[model samples]
Target: MKQTVEPVLQDKFERRFLYLRLSITDVCNFKCNYCLPDGYRPNGTKNSSFLQLDEIQRVVSAFAHCGTNKVRITGGEPSLRKDFTEIIASVAQTQGIEKVATTTNGYRMAEHVAQWRDAGLTHINVSVDSLDANQFNAITGQDRFKQVMSGIDRAFEVGFKQVKVNTVLMKDLNDYSLPQFLDWIKHRPIQLRFIELMQTGEMDDLFARHHVSGVSIRNRLIAQGWLLKSRQANDGPAQVYYHPDYLGEIGLIMPYEKGFCTSCNRLRVSAMGKLHLCLFGEGGLDLRHLLTNDDDQPALIEFIQQQLETKKVSHFLDQGNSGATPHLASIGG
Candidate 1:
């Protein structure tokens, strides 16, 4: 069942590069305050609307055929998918997929890290907003900090080489823990990423509450001797910085604070197989139809290419009022 391979040309004219963010499912175990707002209801349709395992494989195959070398599985929490291991194994086996990774909340990574690693998961990024148990509980709406931390420890113990801790800096909330979190990661192998809050979902209001820019955080860290240098040839949005004396690196993803849209080279596939050309896009291509109807590989490839041709050079968040784009959780951010 080897899928056909094709050459893909990135929008930036970069050759032999494709990074796909595949969302396996929209279901998540944790109700993070930033991801989900109060009084929010699960869009119940997602459970039934998720792409089948075979459909996911076909899509990955098509992407790989089109020269996709890297695939990162995400979800409401990717580990929640029952067939997650199989999915990872299938993607890892794809011809052009050089790397297979996932981003999870770390609730189940402890129990599943070894299994995922065996299934060919190369790296993982675990979301841990706060180090303190009480603060963690408040941020994630769960009292599972112990479980999450345990999962992180197990991931590193199980030989996951590039384990990163993604922390969203929410002002007056998790912002206070910035120095403490960076200090905590100094001795660990895990890289730390401080993400600036984006306007998505119910987070639009919280944007003003937690909108700590990456510049402020970096300047603060630099004042404390954290040397911020760039990493060459890294994929995705994060601007990575390394501390020469420290064991691991720190990344600052300032998508909102600093627009990196000119060099954006990645696309997103929602759990349902919608090809999102831009993170803030209002619409997506229905890739499920191409995968399910006669498995039209050529047509699918053309469709993606055409979409990319129309891909806006950059998004204009300033054009519309605050409520323009949908929430990030729904789009698998």
Candidate 2:
């Protein structure tokens, strides 16, 4: 029951890598066409995989002891996990951990936001691709738009002040709804992030067919009288922009067009406990094995440092090239 500890500075970059996106489960409730293909199904034995909750705690604690300050729980949809609140509480109770967040599809958030907040959850990032119900269904293959909207409202009601709406803008799909989506958050203090679609999983054609850049989206917003002013104190992966007259902030994360590898300070631990240095990386260090081997904190910390040192500065995926990498979902976008 050790409290969260601050992350120790590593020599990979000048900044201390304090943030970790812990994917608790690879299993997702919704079959988003972009995330998973139409005919996709789990290939192996059901019980043969997935990291245990205790294993997660051990790994997270180890990272915290190494000076990690923030932990974000993500999944196919994290809320679908039965012990999600327990996991949140466990991560929050860690001594030096300053923030505990979760990114969910928001399908089941309405029934659990207050419970999560009570469990010491600091923030929530809900993914909503389209404001239109039918379009949403087409994108996610789930007719749960109303449920998600209700969840957003409930998240606000539960005192989660830093609620962010993550929208993956695909060309010709939900790109046109950007302004309307921004309009919905214009008066609220919510953060609306527009993510460029990356070629991953079964969406290679989709990425090729509708590759929309953040600049294009920003220009469109500008043409509509939405003035975007760059924020002075912004950090993290997203390029933040704000309207002087508007209430909320807009974040544009264009991984494809512009590379942020030099200033990138994030590390991703998959649902299975593999440490991925880059989102487009093909390999990772198996942290679950380290946890199960022994409570050897020093060994674990050394392994993490070794992986970080080997981390690539950035990733480049050329659509026209023959040997391009896989999509973002498989790599945990």
Candidate 3:
């Protein structure tokens, strides 16, 4: 059935996309300093219009047909949705989709992760910006550090091979805590990912104050005998590193790195069903109407391909242009 797809999804630069990051909802509960510093706010009356289960299925089917083997269900906090497990199951059961992953704030994860695993989820990524309880509270506006740690433990007890922990590196915040992060993952099978703070349209002052360079960290890792891991076709943009002595691994997501877009292999679909070519792209194309009918597969696929032609060679972050991304939560950064 997969062979029936007319053409593979590739842009003019010969970059073929095999990963799709689909946002199920834009609502988040945690108010992280780098992302939603103040907290989640409803964007008028558009919350009810998020893509439904059937719509998600059609979108995944179209991408799967176009050779997308990995689909990561994202959101401001995807687990905030009541039917989060159902969303995972639907995306997992789609034909040609080999991986079903999600990123969450780890709220009530100890209570819900087991059910998520039972629902056909293959990968879990939790955000824990700082290991210190007080620091974590200050960073995320929540005093749930112990809860998140327990959730990570529960994930392993439930038979997950590995769990990724995302730590958004911020100057004068968690930047000096890398040693603690390394030690925490030394004996555990956690892939600790250090993400550089990105500038968005609404976070100029915050970005200017807290932005840190991942290159310095990468250099430090290399000097300390960390070996780089080559990326798979359907993998995300993180530059993964490994060490023989440590049981866990390290990854850096540096969006400002040179040639970062050359390895771009994923596309994004907002919760409202608009296709976003780049995270920092100017705007999105409306795709919700086409997702309503099963018979619109051909048209939907054609529309995606046509839109791919207009994707830029690279983002304009270096030039201080964050485009339409008001915040990471809006499109599930």
- lDDT per prediction? 0.78, 0.76, 0.92
User: What's the C-alpha lDDT at position 39 in model 1?
Assistant: 25
User: For model 2, how does the per-residue alpha-carbon lDDT over 300-333 read when each residue is reduced to its tens digit?
Assistant: 7888887777765567554343122243334356
Candidate 3 runs further than 4 Å off: 1-5
For model 1, residues 173-208, the per-residue Cα lDDT tens digits are: 878887688778778887898888877645667786
Name the best candidate (by lDDT): 3
Error of 2 at 150 (Å): 0.3
- The deviation in Å at residue 61 for candidate 1 is 1.3
Candidate 2 or 1, higher lDDT: 1
Say which prediction, candidate 1 or candidate 2, comes out ahead on TM-score: 1
Q: Give the TM-score of candidate 2.
A: 0.89
lDDT of 3 by residue, 1-333 (tens): 366536689999999999999999999888898888889888885777999999999999999999999999999899988889999999999999999999999987899999999999999999999999999999999999999999999999999999999999898888999999999999999999999889998799988998989999999999999999998989899999999999999999999999989999999999989999999999889999898889999899999999999989999998899999999999888
User: Residue 268's C-alpha lDDT in candidate 1?
Assistant: 86
